[model samples]
Target: MSVFPIRFLTLAVIAFHSNSFAASGQEQQLFLLIRQLDTLDTLVQSTPRFEAPESNARYRFDYPRLTQDIQHIRQGVKDYLSPSRAQPRDPNELVGDYRLDAAHAEPWP
Candidate 1:
């Protein structure tokens, strides 16, 4: 395989991790969490398919991890919505500190 893809990925990662891309520590963490949740959600939605079936077709899935990710993603969103660090703020204003700028928006898988 060519070394270019890996090098490009490394550079892209480095470029996005800069402070200019994220407004604050909380926003950065939210960005990462939402990105991860989106990735996991996409992966969970896609299932492997076979043109032909085998006599004993079986596949292993991590149900626990999937459930854990769902729970964590829920809490992360709640935390992101909360204005204060201790308790949640108004439910109507859920987008408390989230930056609307696309620059801070992490890519979804």
Candidate 2:
């Protein structure tokens, strides 16, 4: 019954739990998106098919709102799954500026 084995087991359990929590969050987000899409489909089906000018105009107006809502939800899912960067550049690629001297350059030397 060594302490080393206990510590290793504890760390492994913690790592597994953290991974499972993150995965569950992702699953919930996906479920919400699917629910939204289903609702939108139902709305489209239940709405009256219009031929009058006024009704057609109202339908056109509603189109953009629905489109924006879908776009927003998609972007939310994308951000949740792959969070946006605070800064554009990768930190690992940052190097001190060192300009090469070309005054004494030779071609392919």
TM-score for each of the candidates: 0.36, 0.33
Question: How accurate locally, in lDDT, is each candidate?
Answer: 0.44, 0.41
In candidate 2, what are the lDDT values of residues 32-79, reduced to their tens digit?
554655565445444444322332232222332333444554455555
Report the lDDT tens digits of candidate 1 across residue range 1-109. Answer: 1233234333434544555543676566556655655555454445342223233434223333443545554564656656456765434422213122333333322
Candidate 1 residues lying further than 4 Å off, grouped into runs, are 1-23, 49-59, 64-68, 80-85, 88-109
Question: What value does the lDDT take at residue 77 in candidate 2?
Answer: 50
The global Cα lDDT (0 to 1) of model 1 is 0.44
RMSD of each: 14.5, 24.7
- The CA lDDT at 54 in model 2 is 39
Position 105, candidate 1: lDDT: 31
